[model samples]
Target: MRLKRNPTARYPETGEKRTVSDEKKRGGAFALAQRLGRSLMLPIATLPAAGLAMWHTARLSRRRTTGALMISVALTAFLTGITEPLEYAFAYEAFPLYAVHAILTGTSLALVNALGIKDGFAFSAGGIDYLINLGKSAELSGGYLAGPVLLAGIGLAYGVVYYLLFRFLIVLLGFKTPGRDEDESDLDTFEFAAAAAVAADRSKQKVVHSHRRA
Candidate 1:
């Protein structure tokens, strides 16, 4: 996300709240720190999902369970680092739910910090490798206390809030959740498609021109 500089919020003599240059520097530093955190979380959190998947699919001998669980877990971990998915998930929801997500996300971060299972992954807890790393570290961290708490808290937070918000949104706002149907915005999809088409056309034309010149 682009950080906006509000001159009104800045020190007047400095002629910037956060000057473009200063903001760029800060952004760079934040990005680097985020990457480091993701690197650390990578090996700390993988085993639970693996074990659960194995148990659930034990009779089937299907690796799909493990693979799917791994991918889902990884994505969730990555979202903790990069929050656009989380942000977008609730962007259309009512204020209370959005507040809950924001508070919960921040609290989750704090809890993770408090557990001493800090993620130094390049990405947030929003990806597969990070979760795998998290699982590994969790294994070494004396898993009984911290492990159960993390798993339960995460599941409860996600399940309760998601179900309640989804119910409220669909029943009240008439918005669609995963299983439901409702009016959807075509503008974003159309614009993206149009942009891609334009880009492709331009690229093809450039290639044609280059060939003709050659």
Candidate 2:
């Protein structure tokens, strides 16, 4: 006689339905994405202020190294929205810290927007546009005093809040950010080597082609 298989029977190793733990992990990932998306608003919202802050910080720094660093940070943030590199480095490992970043970003945006401060640019928001706008007219550009004050406050709040919240979350969650995961480290190293090899090969080919033309 043929035996009938049970429809509800699950393999010992693989369960048919997702467990609570699995569901939580999925939820965490979604939450991280949501927070990261929200965090973007902060950078985009503070483009003009961020550019001004960079310029002011660079001017205030007595040391060349400090000024260079400040300028680089400002330019990168303004031009390309490259905040993701640093943000993702922290976000992938310490999701809670990223969440804090998102909250702070939203708060800063709200505060600035509430003050009726608005900046427009044809290209990416950054130092170039900020300076351009400033050159145009101080009064026309939402006045001088309120814009600077709001920017300063937002900058200070971002720095302090991010530091405190990141530290607290890291300690509390024991997050495994970059350099904390063995497997991830190995993978990164391999990928880097592979990319380098490909770049080197391309360079060599270019040199050979140039010699052939010559």
Residue 12, candidate 1: Cα error in Å is 31
Model 1 worst lDDT run, 10 consecutive residues: 13-22
Q: Which 10 consecutive positions of candidate 2 have the poorest summed lDDT?
A: 12-21
- Model 2, residue 175: what's the lDDT? 65
- For residues 66-183, what per-residue lDDT tens digits would candidate 1 score against the true structure? 3343344334434433223223323453355456555655655565555554222322233443454454334433463454345445544544544454445445654322112223
Candidate 1 runs further than 4 Å off:
1-82, 92-96, 113-117, 144-157, 173-214
Whole-model lDDT, model 2:
0.42
Best by TM-score: 2
Report how far residue 92 has shifted in candidate 2, in Å. Answer: 2.9
- Deviation from native of the Cα of residue 133 in model 2, angstroms: 2.7
- Residue 45 in model 1: shift from native, Å? 13
